[model samples]
Target: MNFYLDVDRTIITKEHREALELNDFLKYLFNTGEVYWLTTHCRYEDTSSVLSYIMPFLTLENYDLIKNIFPTTWNTLKTEAINFSQPFYWFDDYLLEVEKRILLENRCLEKWIKIDLDKNGNNIMRAAKSHNPNLFSSI
Candidate 1:
């Protein structure tokens, strides 16, 4: 399965904080393979920098695979990038209602995970750890 992610509040946790930590949700997605950035931050350098920043949290064995799938730049919205023919997992704190409707229409709602950074707080680091691993077994 392919993974799409948002950076800002979804990954970085804080906009003003220069040094950031990897949250569990992101770690799980990275390990899953072929992770692509879906943020409004379209610069290639910034994307690379964040990937490097989270390096320590990632398993070294998957580093090469992760690098191969990491996008150099992101210029499209997650909703725009999604292709329903292929299975994809989208993680973002702010998916619009219209976007949700599109996913439902396309029968892609199962993989469109919505996360709230504010409510989850720092516990976002533990978010994916407790999930049912078989939840996507059929995918």
Candidate 2:
């Protein structure tokens, strides 16, 4: 499945604090090949600046796979995504409402997922953890 993410104010940040679990979740998604794509609608300058800031933590492979980044406008990208399959996920604080609207309008995309800006509490990570043999407690 492909995971499409909005760049600015989502993954990259400078001020305040970010959740370590959420950060680890993202790194797992990219490193484990669980997500097929990551996208953004932000301007080039903002994307560039964020990428520079995040470069230290991301591996070279992740930097390469992120080539799927598309320069898309918010309204227009919806139409392009209409016919696509593969359990696509849209991750961004900016896209939550839009994703809901699109899901309502486009019946074909009902299977797609809209991930919140917060990425914890009973999600893919928990699902994966369920299968772990080393987990001692009832997690």
Best candidate, TM-score: 1
Residues 26-112 of candidate 2: C-alpha lDDT, one tens digit per residue: 665565334432344343323554455455654555455454344333334543443355444455435446655776676634334
Q: Candidate 1 — worst ten consecutive residues by lDDT sum?
A: 15-24
Each model's lDDT comes to: 0.57, 0.44
| Per-residue lDDT of model 1, residues 61-136, tens digit only | 4344445445535344457766567778776768778788888889878676665555555344443222324443
- True-structure lDDT of candidate 1: 0.57
Write down the TM-score of every candidate.
Answer: 0.63, 0.44
After the best TM-score superposition of candidate 2, give how far the Cα of residue 7 lies from its true spot, in angstroms. Answer: 3.1
